[model samples]
Target: MVANTQMDADKVKIMGSKVKVDSIMKVADIEEAEKQKMKRKVDKILAYKPDVFINRQLVYNYPEQLLADAGVMVIEHADFDGMERLAAVLGAEILSTFDDPKSDVLGSCAGIEEIMIGEDKVIKFAGCQRNEACSIVLRGSGNHILDEAERSLHDAICVLVSAVKNHRTIYGGGNAEIRMSLAVHDLANTVEGKQALAIEAFSRALRQ
Candidate 1:
């Protein structure tokens, strides 16, 4: 199954510049589990995908496409801003006895597919609403880029799937939609080479 969502700037203004979104999902091990249960789970997700994408991403992120989809969108322009969202996915299938087990799951990018926009201006975002807080990196320091990207990637309706709140992933990450904000690169401590340019870009992006 697949889902698409988008958000744009104008709608953002009317709906308010900021939209609040928070979710929780439960992931269970399907190993040794029955067939009917698995079918039910898949059906549940496909059903809710549309509702969440429309109601949530639409009012928030405000991408040029105006709808935030599972795939990604890369727009090109001189006045470009960069946004990367890291979503946490739960991998385990069966084993539902535990409401919230200390297990790990797989994650997917909220921008499931990549959709290009504009011949010059580009904006991108990613999300992980399954079992982890996706990491979204905003480039160019565009004004509130982090918040903008986060809002764009909040697409999944049932993806806030919860594993043990503090459960670690197979790669040593947590299982929650934790939002961490940062610039294209770290410049606070390092001022070498093009650090000045990077900083300038960040500053302009922040103010722009």
Candidate 2:
């Protein structure tokens, strides 16, 4: 299951830094209330019986221990974009609250395990229900190379997606740009105003 809520002991909200309670017993009551609130949230999550828990926010030690004890693999602090992509791939819902969780809302995968990629450990989810969705991890010796690689990869993926969606192909090697430049220049010649200069300049820029 994918969740965005922070998995931690709930804190009591007071108006000021120092509050005078009716009795010392009130302090104990407040602490117990916090515990109960956290326990309830944990219980609600466990009721779903998900094989793995993916949280977009932090999973504090207390609740983390409980989830660990339940034999549920916990992945915490996943960014919003990642959670969205993961949920899509897994065919799961992004649930902020586990209350009244739908039976079919959980995502499925063949397995999840920690794997070493370069010097870092990453959790790999295999055999997602949405076979079309996949993740690629890029590694590089330097940040600049990695950034450039990522930009190139993004452009490539966007092109691929556009081609797939439109079922069309175009000429490579700046052929399309040259064609546009030629078309714009042809239009510029027929224009009878100062806008012709702007159009001609744009055409030349495209050619370059």
TM-score of each: 0.16, 0.73
Candidate 2 lDDT over 1-208, as tens digits, reads 8988977666666765886789989988997888788888998999999878899999987788888899987899997887888999999999988779676999898988899998888888898988657789898899999999999999999998898899868789999999999999999999979999999999999999
- Which candidate number has the best lDDT? 2
Off by over 4 Å in 2: 11-18, 22-24, 171-208
Model 1 misses residue 139 by how many Å?
A: 15
Predicted structure 1, TM vs. truth: 0.16
Q: Tens-digit lDDT track for model 1 on 27-85?
A: 12222132334334333433333222211222233232322243433222211111111
Give the lDDT of residue 67 in candidate 2. 85
Highest TM-score scorer: 2
